[model samples]
Target: MHQYVFSGLRVSSEFKFTIADCEPFDGSPDVTIRFVQYLEKPLHPIFADEIVTAAPNDVWFCASGDLAYRVKDGSEILIQRGENVPDADVNLYLVGTGFGVLCLQRDLIPFHCSAVEYNGHAVAFSGESGVGKSTLAAALSQLGYGHVCDDVCIANSAQTPMRVQPMPKGLKLWDDAAAQLNIAQGARVSADLDFHKSYVNVDRADQTGGLMFNRIYILDNDIAPEFSIHELKGAEKHAELRRAIYREEWLHFLQEPRKTFDLVSTLASKVAVFAFKRPDDLSRIKESAKFLALHFDDGDAE
Candidate 1:
């Protein structure tokens, strides 16, 4: 039995299951996830057998003759066939459901970014879905940077210096971007129906050493091909950090939203933000990568 730990939770081998061999759901959630395996075969069935279609937001599922079921709560969920579950300390079935669980937990302020270790601190690339977040991270990976997280990045902001946890070891890339990264055709893990994601270890790359983020670049396609690394203050910076925080669905679950908001606000204040432009030509990806590397290295030395 194997045990995998993330954030503060422990996943044990007893809950492991395979998605490839498991049965597929005829009616799946809006977020298509194929890797649905249980860490511990639930004390009983965890999902509903019949699809209960209602409003898109109200859709819920339960395994026939079983009390356990999955209810849609703005978070993503996937159940796939023959997906293998790894051994861990926790026995809850949904603990390993997807990155959403970790993202939504009230304890962590999750970010929708691709994080990598640069020097000793973590550098996170945050922005909108198609804003080249993963693309930039993949580019960094090729340049010898280590990966920490992809879409869902969990962090504890209560400490003097915020701490982050590694999500799953996977990179979700669009079809075109996957080709650019030279990832083999068969080397992807399915996240939803439309997207194909790949997972790789940071150590596998030539880069070594963790990076303490001295700068954060927010991808802005609307802007001209330019760069602005500046200090943000006042309500504007707060708004930016709020927008960058991931797992919005879970915000309502918090006992006090203001406390969470304040914590995030403080964390964002401690980091630097920059606006980066997306290059017009594909040939300039390396140039963009170099720009980022030099920016961090230079800033860290000062």
Candidate 2:
């Protein structure tokens, strides 16, 4: 068995993951992954589609890539891979959408954002796909900011000050972004062979514990020439945070409307949210990072 720490949860899995490995612990794992030949579907499923059949704590997900999984009680995952499916394909689902569902079952909120350490606080960049969240984060890392996580920002919403757990993952960038940042020549691992995305190492932050998640920037590509930051207030804050929920489609299966609302409300109240707008130009990404650094400096001065 291999031990790994993911989003602050100590996991024991039958198969090794690309995540940061940890020494084996004495106690039972917070989460476990087991390989199984077959999995029985939930007898009483609350939500059933062609691909997913989910109950309260039992979910059977069948991916388009011919992979299947049964995640139970937010503590265990049973994988049933299709014929000749590679470990990489299985891992892609396990870490992304599967983990998002697990977070909901554990009462944790998963924000689909790129998080980094800036001025000793976890700052998250969230927006729609292809909106350059990871690109901006990679640029910030070039300027000495620590990369916390690339894709998912998992938060412990049970606490007063929501803590963002470090995923401790390499920055995954497309081929263009990698070349643009001039890190293409570095020793990197291919994240996805088909997508031409590669995982390049960055100056990672401390991965032992969670950081106080403070700020969230919703990246927006605007017609403006220069970068602009607009503070979001009241309903705007709440709305932006709600829209950033990772795999929000699965939230309906794990029905907890009041809990979800409370979590988002508390997050909006504690953290500052802003609309970070810039021109849709990848060449000026370094300038964007500089602008953000100066913004943090201005905040420190105030």
Candidate 3:
């Protein structure tokens, strides 16, 4: 039995995950993941025809080649790895998609952002998959901001200060970005065959949150000709949050739309949301991070 703290929960897993931040847990874990072979389809018809469907407190899926995952009330995750047995891929699905589903079932707000701490607050970067959220975050790490989590932001943790929780291994970036930033050499754990991405240990977790989650920066490459940031308001604020739900594909079968809506609304009201635009040029990633730090470091980022 391997134990670690992940997404604000003490997680016990049957297999040791390479990148899980090391933390201690007493008694029993808050969540358990048991690995098994051969997942018999659910006996009910609730998700008979779909690849993925999420109910109020559960999510069922039979995707990722032969892998099948069942998330129950956020307490346990039963994974049938089937023939999809690559360790790298397994960790990817478990942390990325699987944990995203668990956060939803557990009533936590999942933001598709790379969250980093700037002077004791979580300033998250929200964007589509290829918009360089991870790369930008990695750059911020070089500038001395601590990494909170990559890919998923579990906002409003049950703990004090209203900080977002940290996920395993921060700043998974393209291979080129690794050299460009001149970061410490790291193991290559690419999720794709092209081998363009690798997880960099830039944001090693020293501890979990005491800082509050403050601002969200939404980025779009096509919209902004130059790097710029502006505050979001009214319908746009709520709408941007809706569009930024991490692993949003699972939301299609979410049974508690009203509950989810209320959660998003509360989150929107609690913090500020901003839209960021930068040209699609990948070369300016460092400059963009500097611009963000200038505004965010003083706690005046709007």
Is 1 or 3 the stronger prediction by TM-score? 3
Candidate 1 residue lDDT tens string, 1-302: 33444433343322343221122333332332223344123223332224332232222333222222232333333342232322211112343324344344344566777766776567877787778787778778788877666765666666656556655545656667667767544444443345455543333221222223334567766755654455466776666676677745434442257866777667776677666665555556666777887877877722
**What lDDT would each prediction earn against the true structure?**
0.52, 0.80, 0.75
Instruction: Give the TM-score comparing model 1 with the true structure, all chains together.
Output: 0.65
The predicted structure with the larger TM-score, 1 or 2, is 2
Tens digits of per-residue lDDT for model 2 on 121-144?
A: 788899888888888889998999
Question: CA shift at 113, candidate 1, in angstroms?
Answer: 0.6
Clashing pairs in 2: none
Best by TM-score: 2
Q: How close is candidate 2 to the true structure, as a TM-score?
A: 0.92
Give TM per candidate: 0.65, 0.92, 0.90
Worst 10 residues of 1 by lDDT: 83-92
* Ten contiguous residues with the weakest lDDT in model 3: 39-48
Superposing all C-alpha atoms, what RMSD in Å does each candidate have to the true structure?
A: 9.5, 2.2, 2.4
